[model samples]
Target: MKHGRNLPKLGRKAAHRDAMLSNMAASLILHHRIVTTKQKARALAPFVDRLIQTAKNGKKSLSARRLVARQLYSPEAVEKLFSDTAPKMSDREGGYVRIYRLGRRVGDGAETAVVTIGMATIKVDKKEKKEAKKHKGERPAGYDRTKDEEIFLEKAAAKSKTAEESAEEAKAS
Candidate 1:
């Protein structure tokens, strides 16, 4: 019996290796970048790239992230997050990562690649924020009350029901 299977079963054990890669991939997604062995980067690049591409489609639901986290089970995945990935791609509509081939690894002979995801910008309505500031003391959306108008409403609400209206309503009820 072996006492320490403590480390991740990275290679040779295939499924476990895949799981480890997936975990690393998820983290890379959230963090936007990570440094690792060239072999690992190579394997992880495709997985994480695809994951970000999935998020690019705007299916960035809690369920999707949770499912990704389940496949990835890595602390990195949750922390690194796809928040940027989804929003960035929300504009472009496709193709997230661009892989650049770097030279060989220092330790091992594995080939290195720098995988970058496209963080395109979508111009959101800054005017909405401006409008919000302008209307700060004014009514909320769909509320057409001016400050004076709102005060009038508040006073109207504060007023005791008129006896005739109350009596009529009471009679109707």
Candidate 2:
């Protein structure tokens, strides 16, 4: 008998769910992308999209800002949404947020996902990528086994010498 129930409860009551969604929406608006659970990402996608739609429809009007402000947790997020995100999305229609499934969590085994603004581009530095590929399967830089062993031996010898000196002092006394 699950009929006409559009919104997911997300394991929280009405007020708590709204607060969590508001915080999550604010974070998503401030930072272009966020990593979260798959279910949360799914819930966040539509929530953020509606805010973007509101901003887009209102065209940065005072009422629109106030309306969006009511749903978002941060005023800065509201400003960014109205000034930056909304304008960028003006050319397009809905679907402002995009969710990408990122495997499962290691600890709790919950499914993970990456929620990102649809227009944002995630960039990886070419030099860093090249270095990573170049050093794949190789020891990290400045890792010298001989040097490490020497340092360990030196420390152990120092400890032994201290112990011997303390023993000699005890015997002399």
Candidate 3:
């Protein structure tokens, strides 16, 4: 009976649906996360992720951001879509958006999902170690820790001598 109506109208007029999608896309870009109906989130993720991928290489191009803005309706959202989030997403070839199921909405019991920007965690040991060391304290120019750990050499020498003298007296020789 309900033929040729595959797309979910989302109970909105055509213009309103377009506007809603545009705003949702922009918010998703700028905030890197957004909440919406499960169906809408599923429809939006791949489309928005592809757009972010496109935005990555288009940072300097005014036309590119404008085009995205036209589709998205917000100038600032477009700016950040091009500048901040896109570059981070550039490294990944695809799959730049994630959808998490958040159960049902209270009003009408409609299903909801959270859409988020995808990021991979890099666990390179050396880089993490370097960052950790930098956070612990300020180091001088040309800093050398292996060399400075030897600053305890004087204390070690004193302890050794005390141990040696005490051992000699115990030996009674």
Q: For this target, which candidate reaches the highest lDDT against the unseen true structure?
A: 2
Worst 10 residues of 3 by lDDT: 115-124
Q: Model 3 segments beyond 4 Å from truth? A: 1-7, 120-173
Query: Per-residue lDDT for 128 in model 3?
Result: 84
Off by over 4 Å in 1: 1-11, 36-42, 58-60, 79-82, 120-173
CA lDDT, candidate 3, residue 107: 100
Cα lDDT tens digits for candidate 2, 1-173: 87886998889998999999999999988989999999989888888988999999999489988889899979999989988999999888888888888999999999999899988867689999999999898987788899989999999999999999999999999
- State, as a TM-score between 0 and 1, how close model 1 is to the true structure: 0.48
Query: lDDT per residue, candidate 1, 54-119, as tens digits?
Result: 554536477667666666776565444555456656666445655566777788777776655555
Per-prediction TM-score to the true structure, in the order listed: 0.48, 0.69, 0.61
Give the Å error, residue 23, model 3.
Answer: 1.0
**Alpha carbon RMSD to native, model 3:** 14.4
Ranking by TM-score: 2, 3, 1
The clash number for model 2 is: 0
Candidate 3 pairs with clashing backbones: none
Question: Which pairs in model 2 have colliding backbones?
Answer: none
> Could you say which candidate leads in TM-score?
2
